[model samples]
Target chain A: MSKEKISSQEIIDLLSAQTDFTKRQSEDFLKAMFGIIEERLIAGETVKIKNLGTFKSQWNESRKSVNVQTGEEFVIPGFRKISFTPDSELKNLVNEPYAHLEAVVLDSNHEVTEVDDEDTEELEPLNILTEQALEIKGLLSEIQGIPLTKDESKIEAEATVEIEENNTAEIPLESIIQIDPSTENLFDKIQEKMHQKSEELSSLEVVEITKDESEIENSIIEIDDNIEPELIVAANNEESKIEAEEEIKINEEIKIQENDQTETKSNYTAPEISTSSNVYEEEKIENHYTENIIENNDKDEITSIASDVNRVSEANNLIDNSLDPVDYKIKRKSKWWLILIIILLAIILGLIATYFLSSATRCWVKYELFSDENKEKTANVKNNILNIFGLGDPEIAPKPAKIEQDSVAIQAVAEDSIKVDSIPVTQSKDTIVDVFNRPRVYDEFIGTEKFGQGNTLTNISKKYYGHKDFWVYIYEANKDKIKNPDNISVGTSIRIPKIDPRLIDLGNPICLKKAKELHDLYIEKK
Target chain B: MNHKELISAISSKLSISKNEVEQMLDTTISICTDQLKEGITIGFQSFGNFEVRKKEERLSVHPATQIRTLIPPKLVVNFKQSNVLKDKLNEI
Candidate 1:
């Protein structure tokens, strides 16, 4: 396991051991196999080996590029590359360890909620409480006047009724205590002062009730022309007592007509009064009740009224508590919306600024590129930009042509110099004709060889001429022995002619140009 | 060349029977496959290296429907050509 890399030699050794072949035989087989695969791939044929993989050659298209430092544009010539795709069995075998693993389909909404659970947990309870408060507020508004609709009101009504009944029973004893000598005389003046305020409130209430009676009389007179005075007296007695009792009863059955005066006044003024007003009302009611005890004037009425006021104040306090969080939440939501809007506005402004800045820079660059004075430099820059963007340009089309012409001109100059220098050598070897039908001299033979299986003229040429392109010269030397240079039979005897130093010179560009020309000529002739 | 031609060529080059060459090739391939299954890199000098590579799991979305699909991770056989082979191929 520690030795991760298995070399080709090891594979050959393994093959020899497993197949009962010699090491040399396995080695030669492996070489021939790989060589044939390579040959087929180079010939643009796909080689598919059973239980292994398919090897194919892919041609990459030529692309344009620019040098980073020099900013010079150039084209990268395309070449073929070998690509191998493994067989399905091999793929499955390699993936055997992870074969059991599978892909799972995930619900987007479920995943999102799971990710947000931490943040939502902190916020959820507050949201639930607020929702509950809103529901309670709606229920309270619907049953605001009905006391039994609220749990606290139901219990308080029962307690108040019991207390009121006990006070009625104890009225005589309370009056006797009021008549006691020492404490009665001392409380006399405070009792009178408190009685004055109660008298005024009661007087105002009587006036409002009388006005309500007048409206009722007008409505009754319209219905029946003659209304009896006895009936009016009965209405007043029942109205006053019922108004007092309805506030204490805290029930839904309270007659709307009888309770209208007091209920309307309480509804109009209750919510406007703050907690301080509530304390003042409590103090005033307590003093008024003490006065009622001293005077012994309908003590039960005073007790019931006091209890009703206390109940109203408690209801108001409950409402205030419920409403405060709602108001706070509204204000918090408004603040968040304002902050979000401000942030959006800032981002929009920043984006606008950046857009303008980029446009300005682009305009400046365009102006510099299009200006007449920098035409030549701009052309070069334009070419570099086009190369960078992989765009073709008409101006760049002539650049390679000019380079080729210059190369041809240089080769012509070199050929002229070579002709002038090789006059004596050409005159000595007048019998030998070159591929171009011109007399060319060669040095004495370096060697003689027989072309065998797997032997190519290019390989032979590389051995002697140091380049595969010089194979044209080998073909020219073996023209009489060979028919087609592309197809040579095995065991063909071929001569390896020693070329003149100037003709096959590696440093001279003319040698390569001449060899290329000869190659094109021979191919055209074939 | 195909399997038959490759086997015949190897047999002729090594002067062995085609059956022997085919057996030797099958053994070589089986051994290489076994070694690769064990996660070893089989390197051939002046040719290429064959090894197992792990492809990571990924999420792919359909362009039109926008349906997300999870691609499970798997081990795959990979081949990387040596620089010598690359240079030889580019020589053409």
Candidate 2:
């Protein structure tokens, strides 16, 4: 940042250690410098410092751009450009003192063109030649350790003298270095393009002439019929060579078919021949030689060359620049749309998954984890198991438990509601309807019962009545035997009988001997 | 009502199937948005009323910085249940 002259290498080495670093560090530093300038410029700000110069923002006006794929135009919004100014010291350092340039322009007659006072002096070739030729020549000369006679190179020896004359001088090295690295690519492309144009122009076919339809009878000709040469002789102007050349080739082809027009009635090969010639001509124009370089050398004939061929190359090269606006706009819009759609879909899927996942998680939380009621039920079942295995407390006896039963005539029951008042053995219809869900459940009934093991009722029924559901039949048959129905007398000898009275009606299976005896008794009694 | 009668009634009305109706009901019932022009009230017969009503903005403190700021005014959907429907459902 100081005004003192210093080598760029020294400056780079001073900041952030580089002694044990790799080439990547060098790239990183350079990238950082470029990135800073680029970011600031893109944000529409100017970077300025005294002497070293100011980099100002240059915003481009919005304009139309084209899409290469579809060849469509779109609007590209205005962006920015980076501009740099070199400090006098940095300028002096970057552009080592160099030799001067001497100029002379030759006219069409090879005579020196007289200088006109009205002409801008900046167009004088001395500065341009110095910047282009002398600068490179000096650099290359220094690198190769060769001596140069160019005036610009000689000034490095006379650097002491320049310090006295100019207070703040421009060495023209600022813009030169800042021109960007890709200019070399542009230069090579330009050269390749010029060569292509030149080749295309050189390949255009010689034109031909054809006889008229009405003149087919006059087979004899007085002239050589070389109309291709007629036009070459017709206009000597090379300025009109391209147009005149194509017409002459067509005329020559026409001449070749004059005698056979009746036989070759169709359009024939004219289509391919014409197009090929056009392609040849286009290729000729595309490979235009470095016209600018030649343009500078030959200002007089340059006008004609540019008018005839360079125009075509210029158009192609402009298309190659890729500064189309509309294409970039479409790309930007689609980029946003793509991002939007991705985010939208992600959100929708997230919501659906969240709904299902939350419900499933809630179910797991309720049923699988931390359920106190379930823990109690499992504890009781575990106790029962332990008692069956004679591993539980002996004081808690393996008591045969009573089973719950409903009043036979009861109907509906609330899912969550429990009966507060017990239904009597002979309850009213309304009470039955509210107490039990169905008549089937009332077949066996009990007001209240103690909880038991899983097979307690089945085992007890088998022990006393030799039937599992006989417990229910006992409760129904002795509806008045016990008031509480749930409270049974420990010593009561209740009569237990067959459950279904209809069992007496179904005929019993016959014993063979009893069947014969019964038949003999019936016959004797008859 | 018993599941048999409920399923049968819903199935016969839809003519398609109860499963299909359940799917449609699934889509129609849950959280969703209704765009309200300047003034409008959405009425879903037994469900409820979603009314776009004027909401007044007031000053409140932002929790982060404890800064009192005035929020903007806008219309918000306010829901109110139909008493007739709510009573009928409570009875069931």
Candidate 3:
């Protein structure tokens, strides 16, 4: 249990201990058993051992890969690999710990609903409201082509004004005056003053209209010079003061109504102005121009008045067109400002959302990496990332062994350093220095090789240790079996022990000197 | 070679009875399986090493239907050939 790898020698020892066979017999049997399997595998035949496993040689096709450090592309030549598939009985035995687990069928519909739920959770009510506002704005822009005509504005305004007037009329002024006698005098005085001002304003307006007509007639007579002055005087004299006063009162009431409507709905001012001007034009035509046209016997006066009425209508159209564009431009400018602000807000919100999302993912990655429960999962993810970067081996089975070995080596080095510090300085300085400098090789064996014809210790050493001079280490490892350095029996198995990498590093001069010293010592002993 | 031929080969090589060889092989396999189940790596020198590895749970999709299935985690027996055996095979 203390040893990680049970070597072939150990297995043979175990087998001999378990049965009545000798060690040599057990070793021979084990060797023969594996030999037949290897031979069959080499012949491209599958060997199935009952209750154990099936061994087969698989041919891997040549493939392309890139070197991680150099970033160079190279082809990995095709080769055969020995693959083993365990028997179902053995597989089940090995998987007994995880036998309760079963493959779960993932429902795609359930996963979609889960994702939608997460999205709904992330959306706040304020965000939904903003989204609705944006939709309504889009619809308004789409419907921008249809003009809101003045007639519709006037009708709407009139309806609202009439409602207000009816509500005010319902609050009877007579009842208010009766309820508060002191306010009654004030109301009567205000009414009397308002009547006097209205009458004065009406008389003045009539006088002004008469004077304006007389001036226009004189101007026409001067232009024609064929018309009688008596006709002009009679045409001017035909205007009645009573009709003019009535028209003035109607104009005043219309103005007051328009003022009230303007206060209630300020946005429709352009349309209201157009409607009011139209009413004024109709009044002038009916009260002054039409009467003058009938009263004058001369056709010239009638034609001139008709022309004047056309000019006034044209002026009103010009005013309406000019005012409508100004109001529209103001509205469009305000809408543009609102749109710009909303866009800015949306961009800010988007930035904030991205920041939070990125931070959440980062926290998740950290949790995955640090949490003990997810250690294996994170390792797999890291390996996948390394593979993507071409820095990891695609075969994952051997990685754990390599990493474990590396950790053991690092721990051994740390322990050796600590041991060096604990050793007393009173001992021989050179031996202490040697102990400190010596690289320690742990009890690990890579594999074994049989002593075949023409195979010397040096050849075996060179094959495994990468240096011909490192033969002494191999002889030292197999000193119990190999009695003499130069002589060895054929077919004797030798365990190729793993050595400390620092002890045989070719690039290190110290390592090379150590190997040379060991060679000299072995030679002198021989 | 098949199982019977393998038993005969080992019996002939070891100069033992077929039954003895078969019994010994079965004992050896049982011992090896027990060790492997305990998470110990059994290395046969130049031949190969047998160990148990844990295969993590993963989501796998079917190629034709694209149905994702969650494959549960399980312990698997894996065998990796030693470099010496690989070289020997290549030489052959």
The prediction achieving the highest DockQ against the true structure is 1
Docking class of 1: acceptable
As a whole number from 0 to 100, the lDDT of residue A8 in candidate 2 is 25
Candidate 2 lDDT over residue span A54-130, tens digit each:
55555558999999999999998764444445345433333332112122333322121232233335246644665
How does the DockQ of candidate 2 come out? 0.00
Model 1, span A1-526: residue lDDT tens:
2339899999988888887779998888888888888878877888888899899888888999999999999998897777889999888888998788676554453332222233565356566777899999999776553332333333332323333343443434334333334323423433343344334433443444443444343333312321122123334554443343333234323333323432332222211111232223323333432432332355576566567657655654654454345435433523432333335434654554555455555654464457663454344334444432335243332232332332233233322111111111221111111222345544467887778765688888888889888988878788888889988888998888877654666764646777888889898888
Off by over 4 Å in 1: A1-3, A64-76, A109-526
lDDT (tens digit, per residue) of candidate 3 on A327-422: 354335333323333354346545545554555556544653576645643454354344323354524222323333332332333221111111
Fraction of native A-B contacts kept, per candidate: 0.70, 0.00, 0.69
Candidate 1 root-mean-square deviation in Å: 46.3
What do the candidate models score in CA lDDT, each in turn? 0.57, 0.35, 0.58
lDDT of 1 at B42: 94
- Sort the predicted structures by lDDT, highest score first: 3, 1, 2
Model 3 chain A, poorest ten-residue lDDT window?
A418-427
**Model 3 regions lying over 4 Å from their true place:** A1-3, A108-526
Query: Which stretches of model 2 miss by more than 4 angstroms?
Result: A1-11, A14-43, A67-70, A88-99, A102-526, B1-92
